[model samples]
Target chain A: MRRPPRALVLLAALAASFFAVPLAALAWRAPWASLPEVLTTEVVGSALRISLVSSLAASALSAFLGLPLAWVLARVPFPGRSVLRALVTLPLVLPPVVGGVALLLALGRLGLVGRALESFFGVTLFGTLPGVIVAETFVAMPFLVLTVEGALKGLDPRYEDAAATLGASRGLVFWKITLPLAAPSVAAGAVLAWARALGEFGATITFAGNLPGETQTMPIAVYTALLRDVDAAIVLSLVLVAVSLLVLVTLRERWAPQA
Target chain B: MAPARRSLGRDAAALLGLAVALSACGGEGGGGGGQSEASRVTVFAASSLTQAFEAMAEELEEDSPGTSIRFNFGSSSDLATQLEQGARADVYASADEANMIRVMDADLVEGEPSVFVKNKLEIIVSAGNPEGIRSLEDLENSELVLSLCNEECPAGKYAAEALDKAGVNVEPDSLETEVKAVVTRLQVGEADAGIVYASDVASAEGEVEGVPIPAADNVIATYPIAQLTDAESAAGEFVDFALSKRGRAILEEHGFLVP
Candidate 1:
């Protein structure tokens, strides 16, 4: 086979290098002197704690909701299903800010469900932890749904039929048969959803608002730092990067089977 | 997942690139402004002033033909950092003076940034006070979720400063990026209360209720504007209009204080 031209190779290299440049730059500018203290600040700590907890909750919730939706979208082909699929994936196209606004419209105190939630249960989502989780889940669920749906369609159905014939309930067959086979994709989806939730900003801010010890996550902390305190912001960003890398690497390991 | 699988080679490369890009992109706006003057003057300012500034830009084009203005509207801290890293803003109008001061300390500004306008902090709640969050002290209740701008954002800083003065610290649920977002959450009831600019609350009108915080009197953040050291001839005119009679009127109409 003919080799790619030198100029083409250079162009591709240039395009690819935009990724590495920013990371190298961050490490280069890392304020090593203040990192330890910055990382431990009460505000940073609280935000990080919220970030970790909310991201995990959202990721788990998304998987719980997304997998079933994925299965239906993939296996139960029906009229307008493509449109339905698009609607489910809408958040991917929607600006996180817009998704946040939509969430507020649906869940805010004056919102339809928001009004019901307050009158019935005295619960208001705005500026609350539940609001944070709701916003994160709204944005991240699509990642899981699309990922799991793809795996479902690519799955071998005969095994599920074999289990059904052996007296397995459809639910049990789904739980025991389809899920195991799709474990890696599901895991990958969960990881993506988790990561998205962990780093989420616009939707969370619009839907949940930042409050320390409540909904302020690391990304929000970092953003605040960049304006209020650059050194602190840099340290928080580094922390976020380190944690994200660790999780992404672990997920990437699980993703190797597909590779 | 199937699409990812099909595009594995390209997508894997892109994904890793994107992660790196995210890490790198976070800090780049501070390092690259060596371009000569007279090409065009790029001014990054807070979003709330988009209408007035764009109107000013249009007027400037008519008044001073050769000179041109490009405005990037967002939060002040974002713009400041962008200035630090060499984003090449010839002028900046921050909703809070502190952000303006931050950029000045970096020696990027041309002169003392004049206090062009003033923004007051107000308690923004959903219309009808559905939760009856009567005042600022109510935010401290664990049941309330609040959103504020990250510390870097002008509005967030002002609120924090005001809260500090009042000796009230409520754990907010999210720290957003801008004032508009904080108000949006309030309107949606994602946050029962957000400390936002009086202008934001004023703009929202009927969608949300604005309760003036008495303690907020201590948190009047002066908005500052100045031509950067890097300004073209156009900078002088822009600054004049911002601080001039017509400019003051436009900002006043938007509910900003005439400095």
Candidate 2:
């Protein structure tokens, strides 16, 4: 391979350092001696539990709902397909706070659907665990859908056609062939969605509200802790950073080894 | 191709001329002989002061042309933490003494902060009192969803104090990070009720109504304003203006008690 230009290399190094500096500063300011005590505190513990539960639930929800959407987008030749794809990808670009406001408008007690839900079933999702999962899913599902859709589009159709010629049903061809072919992308997308959900702050805080052990996920906990306890906030932030780093490293090694 | 490139070059030159003209206009305003040089003062204040401070900024700017005020509004504790972390601002106005003391302890203030206004806690509900919430005890209704500020927020602390004083053991469905968020929860009807400063209800522009907490059970929040140690000359003037009679009248009109 041809060597990169020196100016390009220099620019890449500068960009790398720009990202490294803040992480270094956080590490430098971390209270390493009190990490164990801080991590084990009730606030941190509950936040961790909530973050884990909500993020996992969001990832599962994304996979269950997104797979069909991704398949439909990839295989269907329907009018307005591009518009539908754009709408699905909208949350990826929209500010999470704005997403939260939209969620409240659609799901709050007085909202269009929310009012009906409240009146008929006495169910309100605001400030509940389900609300956090909903907010997370709203922001995170696009990643899974987009990733899986790309994978589905890139797959060779001959394998499924060959299976169909062998008298296998469409469902059997999909389950026994197409799904297995796209398994790696599915795994990668699920992990990406989980990481995005774990780091979600704005939408959850705005839509679900920040209640400890219920809606106060790790990001919200870190923010609340930052106000009163710098050390605790640093510890919580470091945990999130470490988890994100792990996700990236694992994805590179398992799914994109060439990179 | 050559003509396209030539037209692009002309477009670039036109853009450069426009930029130069804009900067020239800006320079003339600052360099005019008889007028004071344009100055910008950044004030970091609590979210509860959003409307009243914006009004004060408009009045102050009108009174002294070429003087502009920028605000960074959030929870008091968040503002204090930013000051401690060396975020530069000319003035700091906290909703409670505790956060102001935190900044003072960090040596961020030029001198002692003076109490400029006081606020009392009130139960905020959606317009027309949809739930017919009338008092603090009404907040205890199991069917009602309550949102309050987290313990780190001054309004949250005040709400907790008031609740304690009233011997009301109602559990909040959500603990928001800022007082404004609690008010927002009520405004959006995500929450049946919330406890926030009286000024918040007044500033909410009738989207929400206040159910007055009896004086005996209300917690008074003392708001203090101070110029930062690194502030410009205009910062002191702004602080003085906030303590002036006109400022007091504005605060009173917004349902705050002037000191």
> Model 2 clash pairs?
none
Chain B alone: TM-score in each candidate? 0.74, 0.84
Q: Tell me the tens digit of each residue's lDDT in model 1 across B43-126.
A: 767777766676777777787766767655556665565455344457888877777888989898897889888878888888
- Show model 1 residue runs off by greater than 4 Å: A1-16, A254-258, B1-259
What would the per-residue lDDT of candidate 2 be over residues A1-259, giving only the tens digit for each residue? 9999999999999999999999998899899999999987766766776777678778778888998899999999999999999999999999998887788778876676877878899877765677889999999999999999999999999999999999999899988777777766666677789889999988887677655555778998886665434567789999888867875685565453243
lDDT of 1 at A138: 95
Per-residue lDDT of B1-259 in model 2, one digit per residue for the tens? 2333344335434534643454344333322223357887878888677678879998999998878786655567756754664445799999889899999998988988999999998899889988998888888898999999898887888899999999999989999977777876775578999999888888775678988999999999899999999787799878998999999889899889887
Docking class of 1: incorrect
How far off is residue A45 in model 1, in Å? 0.6
Q: Kindly report the interface RMSD of candidate 2, rounded to 1 decimal.
A: 21.5
In terms of DockQ, which candidate is strongest?
1
